[model samples]
Target: EFIIESRDIVGNQRVIGDDAFVVEVEGPSKPQVSVQDRDDGTYLVSYNVQRTGTYHVRVSLDGHQIAGSPFTAQFHPGLVMAVRCTGVGRGLTRAYAGENARFTIESRDTHRNKTTSGKKPFVVTIRGILQVQVHALEGDNGEFHYSYRTPRAGVYFVGVLLDGVDIGGSPFKLTVDPGPAHANGCSASGAGITGGYTMVETFFTIYSRDYYGNQRTTGGDVFSVEIGGTASADMRMRDNENGTYSVAYTPMIGGDYFISVMMDGVHIQGSPFNIASDPMPRESYLEMYRSMEPTFKEKMEKMLLGGDVTGVKDRKKANSRRGKEAAQQKSWVLNIKLLDANRLIPKDTTVDGTYGTGLVQSSDPYVVFTMGSESVRSTTVLKDLNPTWNEEMKLPVENRLEKLKVEVMDEDLQDEDDSMGTAQVSLTDLVIGVPKMVTVKLKELNEV
Candidate 1:
């Protein structure tokens, strides 16, 4: 039933008299409808549906359709047979590998009554990354179970068949997660060149192990390095041929550097190590400068004017050039609004072969705006297909020809975040002082 109020031209509620209103319903078999006049500027419409289909109910004022008319309603036949995982009466269900899962199929007649007297033999089958064994419970009606550990990780299909016909909610899907990483007995510490001079090389060591405390000899594990200081460093890691790994750090300028190490995307023990380096001696600094060829000095000077300084140079000239370059750089104020998305792939996977449902299945989307090496990100919009985020940012643009890259990613808890799509906008065409609204069409990563 729909409640519609009529209003006059001046926005006052108007009473629709009995003679002024008419109601008609069009459906599959032309359901009989009755109209009752309440005499208080209101009318009641009642209809008995005889068929299962869509119906269009139109309300007219006098001989014309009202402001809001022709509403649609759909009806389905009464519930027939329903099937679900034993413990789960309805909706989605999940189970882990090597665990027992039971399914219960409930049968109901057309009269909306449950009956098991004429139950037929039901077939249950499991298929996916790997097939598992499924068997019917002995002496149980419409009950079956499956127990088997999958060797691989992926989605699995569970199907229930009654009299060779698929029942309601057949071919249920489940997901399987990768096996545990067994990262229990790992250790990391500073091993070499705890302190050094600028441009000098230093190193550290990390010992990786599994949950059993046995050293991991395999080389598939990944390690990352992060350095924090005014000046950056060249950092890389190398396997020491033993179970331990060696990380090399070469300081670019003299200062204190904080080093952080991560294994398998997690921080290692005793991370954020501090290493101190002294400035190069005057003699050493001069020797490095003199080692350059005569023509190379001019190239070096040109690079230093652009903030790429290696050797010590005239401070006054370098500062003056830097000031000029800073003045020429443009700063942009951006008002970003993340509107919505369409046709996004599901990223959540489980060991039971069930993908996420409802909000869990939707993406926790966030936008990352990048220009050259500088990047800023908007706050995450949780579990929505049409997320609205009106955020603004101010950033300096060093290169006018560089395109602004926008990447949409889905945040995950168990693994690496997944990229949904990306878009690019050319900044050179945008007016400096004017704010322009742009609708970026997100495309797959490989799409140009």
Candidate 2:
């Protein structure tokens, strides 16, 4: 609607109407228009268009164009047609988590015509873990641009509203992907790193997170871990595919170890973790070194020779408990046609100080064989109750009907060797040329 006032050549307002006024609208479609004279030389023009487009409104007086002859006007749909609004941008498809997301909206009517008037009243929202805030701006043109952001990744529903009404695509499905893992957000955990024991299989776990402190759901995150110091060794990593990884490593030699965890060539939350691994127990040396070599005695000798001893130490004794367990054990493999003294009674008592600190319960025991007219004695074993003396001992056998006597005795450092027990064997009916294995019962021996 518009009002026009007539004037005289002297620029004075006219008191009464004089000339005829003409109003015409030119556009793609026709519209309802009307002109009214107010009797005071003023005219009123009102027009309403059906469709939306650019139109020219012309005003003329007495077959001649007025001072401002024509005016350009744009017709847009009303705000009631918000459901016809359309949105377009990359944010509608996918977005990167912890980053800005943007898109544009074109306000339209039922016929999809651009709108130029209204309060807008646009409400944009994204359904995510966090309450996202949206910012909308009106461009110089009739387009509406909206932006929003969130730190979480997932399939989120986005809504665009205008005047309390949903837009064409109100619930936009937006897929968010996790960003790269951040150093400060990644962390490590587990027994291998915090509560590690030497010469034992230990493992740890690593968790990966993004810059926004959100856990990544998928794998493909690369990491580098290195163990250093006296317990240095290679660490193995297993990807759990859920932002967590398992790291495995064994401390061959116990001491201090430094564990470094890195993600994407950068240090994680607690990189270079320090841990002190305690040495393995003294009794477990056999089990620990058995896998190191094929033969049991070779592994023991190697461990003993390398001074890889653990547990308590007493620098004064000429024969330590460990030396007694390994050296005096005499655990050799037995060959055919040989007399093998496998093991005897244990020497070390449960109480400490096997070197005689007032207690003399255990002893050093050996095997003695009385064959023919001569008697022979093997070396004595110290404190280890479970001894190994596998060997091949050959003696002259003159009489096949003669009996052989075998005895076990404990050596007394201050007196004569005491007899623990004795086994009596008689070879009177033995077969010649063929090797013979005799079994005998000891007279005074209980199972050790």
lDDT of 1: 0.59
Count clashing residue pairs in model 1.
Answer: 8
RMSD of each: 21.8, 28.0
Q: Write the per-residue lDDT of candidate 2 for residues 159-193, one digit (tens) a residue.
A: 88776777887777677888788987888766566
| Tens digits of per-residue lDDT for model 1, 26-102 | 88768776777665555677887655669889988768887657888886544444442222222124554333445
Q: Candidate 1 has which clashing residue pairs, if any?
A: 174-353, 174-354, 175-350, 175-351, 175-353, 175-354, 176-350, 176-351
Q: Model 1: runs farther than 4 Å from truth?
A: 1-92, 106-120, 139-142, 151-154, 175-181, 184-314, 318-448
Q: In model 2, which runs have C-alpha deviations exceeding 4 angstroms?
A: 1-80, 116-119, 282-294, 297-448
lDDT of each: 0.59, 0.67
- lDDT of candidate model 2 versus the reference: 0.67
